[model samples]
Target: MTLHPQSRSERDPETHRAISYRTTGSGHGAIVRLMSPSDLGHLIKPFVFLDLFEGESSFIKGMPMHPHSGIATVTVITEGNLRFEDADSGTGMIDYGGVEWMRAGGGVWHGKEMSPGTSKRIQGFQLWIALPPALENASVDSQYLESGAMPEAGPARVILGAYQGVQSPVRAPDGMNYLLVTLRAGESWSYVPPKDHESLWLSVSRGTLAAPGLVDAGEMAIFEPGNDAVTLTALQQDAVFVIGSATPHPYELALGNYSVHTNPQALRAGEEKIAEIGVRLREYLRQPNDSASVPVFR
Candidate 1:
């Protein structure tokens, strides 16, 4: 579908209005950066950096081990599947609605934790959220949850926060809400933001949605800050997408090539921790028999 900007006059005043919009940009490999720290991330704060990717399972096998700190990554699979292996979680398959959450607290290196599953091709999103000060330097924690483990409220799957009294199993921080939703053609859904949630945006995986304004596939729409409710309607074909809302992250972002922290001191500490962990990771890989390790970005 042809993608273009939507005029203000075209939006319905009673529903949420699109203040800004972004289309995913091409990236180095089989991934696209939907949002990043250098771009719209500043406006969204805690909700920073989003990558949408799709490729054969073999494509992911090429990703090298990397390290991260001061942020948490959430991986959501919308199509196909992935095999997750970790000493703690053992081996399991994550298909549609499945999530892999990794809090790169102090520091950690990963890349081998997940491999291709039964599906030949897999499609999903990886979202990076800046951690709050208290948790940024804590020990790393990870979880792999299957589709059945996530709770559903109406057409939406509660991915990271509470919705309609259903809370997600993921131990995410407060003041944010993320949901995975699917709408059949001609179906409509309305979202009422929590009293404190001021930042809101959505990206569609497939089909078209009229969030009162036409949002084509792969396009992201950022709404004006407010508590006003938003309504969306699927145009043609079934629509699958993710929506997020959060209170502003109340700190400055000290950015690194692979990390984000609230301040420079914290950033430095996180990097130091990552360096220490890298040593252990390399040694572990050297003698690993069947241990599962998560992919780490440099």
Candidate 2:
């Protein structure tokens, strides 16, 4: 298998952090949050942090025009449409239950909105995958993959990675896997990590999930590989979660809003690079990409 377990020196645990965000957009799309990936360094490796946001009003909105570098960001929406427009890359738009992936090779800038209509409920997850050192200084670029375009693996909907021989079109510079899994009530599923990958982390979104043990909603758990595989079962009527695991990589991490890096200097450079790109995106801030775009219009 392309995914194999790493040695003791390699096997690492996933560290979970609280969902914290800053208010960014105007009206209702303003909360901008960062998941601390650098807090754990890079042992389990490819994954940096998991950010969850649910906008209740226009004041607590989504992110606005911002830059990212040395990493990839996967935005998966569960409720409400999210409008996305990037000046550094091309334009993108995605609707309810959509997913937008951007590989900020060097750097890229983007803005997102909450549900444009009156439903008012906007729920989603934004994940960060650290870029390899080679691409840390490259020019920024992005690509969008609709939610429907993502492959399904068993009970799990793959948004940015692969599972059970099924794969997602959203490729990552790092050998990483990001999966969104939803299991029906009383349903049980087993996740066998790719041999090259060692650590597995799961975050519960709704309902209850059980591994060898039970994990309730709003909780995060880390599983160590080499012990066969970890199994998850929905304990309630329905449950959903995001699982991420990948091959270990040797890299440093420095994280700031909208970006992740291997070094502090790189982080500072990324900020400056995006600030420069922000000037370009500002021109189109008022314009909205149509529904055809991969970045959703919330």
Residues 85-165 of candidate 1 have per-residue lDDT tens digits of 887777899999999999998888887788899999988889899999999999889999999999999999899989899
Task: List TM-scores for all candidates, in order.
Answer: 0.93, 0.74
Predicted candidate 2 versus true structure: per-residue lDDT over 1-298, tens digit per residue: 0112223443224312211111111122333332356443244557766666666635334334456788877778766655455444454446444677666866775455222434466666777778888777676555555567777888777776577888777766646677888889998888777777776677676788756455666555555544246767798579878877777767767777767788898888877887777666665555785652223111
Error of 1 at 71 (Å): 0.6
Q: What is the TM-score of candidate 2?
A: 0.74
